[model samples]
Target: MTTVNRSARGRKSLAALVCGALAAGGLAAAGVTTSLAPGAANASSHREAPLISGQPQYDNTDVYAFVSPDKPDTTTIVANWLPFEEPAGGPNFYRFAKDARYDIHIDSDGDAQGDLLYRWTFKDHVRNGDTFLHNTGPVTSLDDPDLNITQTYDIELLRLRNQHVISTTKIADDVPVAPSNVGKASMPDYAKLREQAIRQLPDGSTAFAGQADDPFFLDLRVFDLLYGGDLSEVGRDTLKGYNVNTIALQVPSDHIRQSVGQPVIGIWSTTHRRNASGHWTQVSRLGMPLVNEVVVPLNAKDRFNASSPWNDADFLPFVTKPELPKLIEAIYKIDAPQEPRNDLVSVFLTGVKDLNQPPNVRPAEALRLNTAIPPASEPKRLGVLDGDNAGFPNGRRLTDDVIDISLQVVEGELLGQKNDLGDAVNANDQPFGDAFPYVALPASGSNGPLAQGQGGGNRSQLEGGSAELTASAGDNGTLVTTSLVAAGAGIVLVGLGLAWWRMRRRDGAVL
Candidate 1:
């Protein structure tokens, strides 16, 4: 805000630019952690708006659409909900919104409107209500006898023409959804349990719905310091140890596309919950991460999420005159680009030209994926900026470091401002699978590293518990499961008290 502050920001802006240019070019495999890595708040759409934040299950967390590596002929679309989930969540765990309709939209014609809509509606089922335990026995399978509380869902694929549903087909009905990774006792061999939930659809497609580690990672504390921390010394990735309910679909390229249509498709995820009038009301929408989290002002965030992309023109001023750069300059002394920021508009609204853009596509918010591009053998998490067209803004891959890419974008990466700007957390807590439904198994409840209280041993139980939830991804430590055992013991104690009271009442009556 002051001249002195602006002077410092100017220096930072130039320094970050130099660092970005070098990183953009060929750099060492163990390259220096770019100085700008911790320069901005790299965030996702989890609880980004006021209204949607209240509806965690209906709130869209992250949307990813990438070419399937195992089956190149197919495309994978994944949408996650119930963000920032604690693996140790108790008696009442997370589930899908039965009252809402979740959808993944594809615009093969590049009109920024869905040409084909894949919708999901869920049903909650309690196998038995007499017991407090979620699982009466070990969950050996998707339909395992031990699983007490469960849920089922049906998927519908609808083709839209002229904004009216032309045809609707039930893709899968009464499909099983895998239970949360409650703990070893409840869900032993989560990997095998996950397989049973991966059902093949009648339309030559596949579906998976259940819990998975929260894929979006970023530094939450950096926002406090105006994002000026060193790459190696910034905020910790708070997203670790969290879980989310996910709905993933793998379909042939032609399923959502006409054989003669465009290869590039615009993808986005949205959720609608029924109002008191019994009419569905759009509550949340997400494509690119942090669009509403940081870009939209507080008052307009809910409206932005509820409105359609066709009305995006109303919010263009925020993208063009972003407040992030001004905040950086005011707090940390860096000058943002002058107004008329075509870069922000293009990146958030329209796809980047010649790289990920659809031909003659109208500017709108959606993750654009070019189906013709083959998946990278060893993908670059940094995305197209790193010469890997198979990742992020080009359709998000599970391995992509969206936080880093987003931080770079925050500092005007598209406007030629390049820095290693990021939260320093480069990968997800879990490793992705090689097959369709590629998400890694969810973090277990009672055991594994992320469970509460017990410095639980290695995340070796699942794939992602690599280190302290707040520590670096490469840092390894043992996770203790003391809390789970304690929790089990506490349940037993409560049950014993009830039984003793019942006996006491009976004896008193006899006397």
Candidate 2:
């Protein structure tokens, strides 16, 4: 390992130590775990990396996959933009990248190479002038509602098989843009406004561009402290009152699928921007294997993002390199009880079951969904743990409780039909709309407390306006202690061994 790599690993070790201590101290007792595990090195989604926390604009907030609830033969792919945007910050609102190239790549052949790509770009209308505030100011009425600050964008459907580009018709002139939610009258009915954004494609596919609810929900304060050293708890609470900006795309499954026989597909998103030197640069990439790059290790994160499924062969060595649990083991100073657990290599890098798969195509980290298997209309939030494979790793849905799913799987739920975790995997409220713009919650008010209403059970509401970002005492602060310290210690020792092996390799010493 390079000196920089070593240093990064060392820092990760120290972080793990602090986090372990905190977890043991019960600091995360009040925290809520959403779809993603907050503190563990085994995070399953993007933006979990320490570096990207400062860059929310490029954060891969959340990934959703489900057969279109309205159209059974089509799939709705919705990728959220801008994590945790405060609804009150207005005047200058958030918008999707205008110059940046946004793409949703799909791989249906099972090889991981994208067989089809949907590309998008936008054009802003900041120059247009219509200076009359409706329901206020001098005049009571304006001649046109369309002459406001609007934007126009185009979509391109690329067929990778033939390298063909199909462009859609331009959205002509100007259209009324949605305003920030300041009051009932100021904000248009969000549902109606979103419907207006949908543009019909020549091929029968439909696309909509506008701000929607953020599907991801986590008690960030709890998780951050957990990683810093608090494990008094082992589960998560649902986020019932938050929202995010989203770009939704729906298309006929056959339009993007490479083969009718296999319905499985790989999906990913990328954001790019032109630098001062006039060169386009990648801001971030979020795909099938979600945060594989972010949580892998600092030294390996960038390399993971720069490579793709097609070129994975050239990057397999780096992809299979392990550093997480090893670093944890080193920091905790404990010897692993098992052989493969000694290093993160065997579990995180090499597949425990299907070992012959391609490098980037490793099932160890990617969200693997067999599309041929029809989705369960009313999927159990616990997913495979509940004998339902329709959620997560199988392709995540908005309501799937991924945090619990990941925790259960890591505890050996995949080993057989029997799950020992029991209620640990069964305790969560999963509710989402069954149509386009699937995330149905409204944008939370800035000063309102985090509300905890059950989708079908015990309901709690935090009313009035209070600028607190935590759940009520009744729902929060529930802690459960476990033998995580011993487990953490075991993983750290494995890291030390791996480090020693690398040192020997550099010194030309025989094992």
Q: Compare the candidates by lDDT and give the number of the best one.
A: 1
Error of 1 at 83 (Å): 0.8
What's the CA error at residue 484 for candidate 2, in Å?
49
Q: Model 1: residues >4 Å from true position, as ranges?
A: 1-43, 225-235, 258-261, 448-511
Lowest lDDT 10-mer window, candidate 1?
A: 1-10
Ten consecutive residues with minimal summed lDDT in candidate 2?
A: 1-10
lDDT of 2 by residue, 84-146 (tens): 444433444455656676666776655655666776676765534444432121211122243
In order, the Cα lDDT scores of the candidates are: 0.72, 0.48
lDDT string, candidate 1, 1-511, tens digits? 0000001123333343234334433343344322111112224666676555445677788888899998988999988887766666666677897898989888887777789999999999888888888888888887777888888999999998867999999989999888888887677788887888899999999999999877766666654564454334465566666678999999998777644346788888887767544556676788876677777888787667777766677788988898877776676565677787787776667877775677777877778787878989989989987989888768889888876776677677777877776667777767888886887778777643344332333332332644323322234543445554576689999999999889989889552
> What alpha-carbon RMSD in Å does predicted model 2 have with respect to the real structure?
17.7
Off by over 4 Å in 2: 1-46, 49-55, 127-148, 161-182, 221-230, 233-241, 312-367, 416-431, 444-511
Q: Estimate each model's TM-score.
A: 0.80, 0.64
